[model samples]
Target: MRLSELANPSRFNALAERLLPWLVVATVLAFALGLYQALFVAPDDYQQGATVKIMFIHVPSAWLGMLGWALMAVAALGTLVWRHPLADVAMKTAAPIGAAFTLICLVTGSLWGRPTWGTYWVWDARLTSVLILFLMYLGVIALWRTVEDPSRAARAAAILTLVGAVNLPIIKFSVDWWNTLHQPASVLRLGGSTIYPTILTPLLITAIAFTLLFVTLHLMAMRNEILRRRVRTLRLMRAAAANP
Candidate 1:
């Protein structure tokens, strides 16, 4: 398919239909393998013991929480700068999904922390930044819902999404910049990963599974949005005809 075809709603819908099944299969298989490895194969952390298993879910949730917003930033640029037709759709669909993952990260992090940090919550820079990110996502989603016109809502949400993106970098570096309780990057760094190979392998696999799940859900959501807009357009046309 041509690059421009990606911008066409009907074309995207067709492509998504074909891709969704494969993506679903891949997501399920990856999750199966990842869970097996994380649960049964990978040994517990020497310190955290059984609680270490939470890392499999928490780490992926954290990564995707950031990734979802980063994706919206790119889609926002497409909306404001390039005026791509599917840009707003992509941005809109990703919000709830991202929010969900961020929520998972927070909940799982808190669960992991109670045992590890001796507390369920904290006001550290990293944690606060993530909370802000989650709120920004809700703000963008609310902006879209309040605006009656799709084009206007797209533009408004696009701007908010871009502005909120600054938080992403802050979240990544907060631990290093301050004396935060959160740990810095371990799996990815200037040097090699600090995590044990057995643990790292499952983490990577689970991350892939979550990412695949995101792509599958995002594509499905976009397809639904396209159809919804079509219905709205048709209804507007019908009302205009009746009034005339």
Candidate 2:
């Protein structure tokens, strides 16, 4: 089905229902295989040894962390420009998930850095930018709650999202822009990835799993948002009927 068709809440719910089960199955299988390759099958890094295993989770979480915000920014444009029916819902539901991934990225990065850098934290540009991105996600969620009216809240949140998008490129280019302890892009670069196929394979698989997981959660959240709106409307109608 076309995405435009799914703009209708009923159609969206129907499509989500059909897709959710398959998504769940595929996500589970991908994760299982990805984990197997990351842990047991893939050879340990000659330098980092077992500590390199964390890369499987860390890289994917970090990728999702950035991707979630970009998705929200797109949704924000839809709300501010075309006023797409599902745009606000997409933006709102994405906040918590993005925050979660950002949190994971920070925590895993710290863990990886502890052994490699011999420290738990640093004020490096890349790390700091990612931290700011996490804060931005939380800020958006708070902004949504602070306003009571749906339209007003959506507009406020959309504005904030667009403004926060400036941080994305900063996060991406921070390493190059500053002399940070964090390493430069290895997987995504102008000269192509520097990672060996052995490590790259599991990372790619896990990244796919993470993306599927995000899609599944986003669809479920949107369905719930639709139901909540229906309930609110019903309650208002019942109250009006009783008073009239």
Candidate 3:
């Protein structure tokens, strides 16, 4: 089916109905396994000790924060270019989730930093860029809420999202391009991941769990938006009939 076809509310509703149950089950299972491995199975870091355990949640949340914003940017593009009905909904729904993940990442990173890095906050390149990214998400969401008309709101939000896309690259490359306290990439580094399998496995599983959780919540939010629009339309139609 075409992308537009998939944007249909009924189609989306049916798909959500079928998929939500399985998604929930899988998310629970993955989260359980990931937590077990992260907390129990994996060995402590030789240097950071128990503080490295935060990586299992913090890294996945940080990754998802960026990934969610990227997805919002793509949805914004689709809404502006193709006028896909669901794209605006997707973008709007994604903002809060992305913001939440970013907040979690920052908080957990601070907690992890206090024990390891001696300070909770830094003006490092990577840290600064991620903060900018979090602000961008807030800006888009605020713009959408401030606009009165639906189309106008969507267009405004899309423009803002596009403009904010610059920060994504900066966040990704900041560690490499600048002298930062944040360690350079290990899992995403050249050659291969430097992390051992035990630690890597739990991290990967937690990442997958975070991804699935995003999908599930995004779909739910989109469904709610669709129903909200439907209610508005119905109310307008009823008012028109009464006036006519």
Candidate 4:
């Protein structure tokens, strides 16, 4: 099928419904296995001891924070360029989830920082950029709500999302572009991972779990938004017919 045909809300909804159940089951299984391995199977770090266990959750949340925004940006591009019907729903649904993950990342980073950095917060490059990303998410959501016209709001939000995408690269490269308190990339660098298999495996699994969770939640929220719009349109049509 062509891209435009596939972008129909009903088609998207059908596909989402079919896939959601399987995704939910996989998310649960992956999370259970990941948590078990992270907490029980993974060996404690020689330096951080039990505190290193936080990495499984914290790192994944951080990864999703960036990933979610990237998804939103792509949706925004589709909305603007292709005029894809489902693109607005995709961007709208993704905002709150991205914001939540960003909050989790910040909170968990603070928890991890206290034991390692001797401080709960720092104005480091990576940390600061992530904070900005959280703010951008909030801004987009608020803008979406403030506008009365749905199409206008979606376009405005799309513009904001596209503009905010400039922050994604900054957030990704902050650890490398500047010397900071936060450690450099381990898994994503040119060289091999610095982490041992014991810790790396659970972290990878948790990252997958978190990604699946985000996708599942985004689809559910999009369905809700579509239903809301349908109801509004029906009400408007009824009012028009009654007046006529």
Please identify which of the two predictions, 2 or 3, would achieve the higher TM-score against the true structure: 2
Candidate 4 C-alpha lDDT tens digits along 1-244: 5766767778877877999999999999999999999999999999999999999999999999999899999999988998888888889889999999999999999999999999999898999999999999999999998997788999999999999999998988998999899998898878789999989999999999999999889989998988889888999999999999
TM-score of each: 0.99, 0.97, 0.96, 0.96
Error of 4 at 94 (Å): 0.4
Top candidate by TM-score: 1
Off by over 4 Å in 1: none
Looking at model 4, the pairs that clash are none
lDDT of 1 at 236: 96
Q: Rate the local accuracy (lDDT) of all candidates.
A: 0.94, 0.93, 0.90, 0.92
Q: lDDT tens string, model 2, 1-244? A: 7778878988888888999999999999999999999998889899999899999999999999999999999999989998988999999999999999999999999999999999989998999999999999999999988997778899999999999999999999999999998889999899999999999999999999999999889989989988987887899999999999
How well does candidate 4 score on lDDT at residue 164? 95
For this target, which candidate reaches the highest lDDT against the unseen true structure? 1
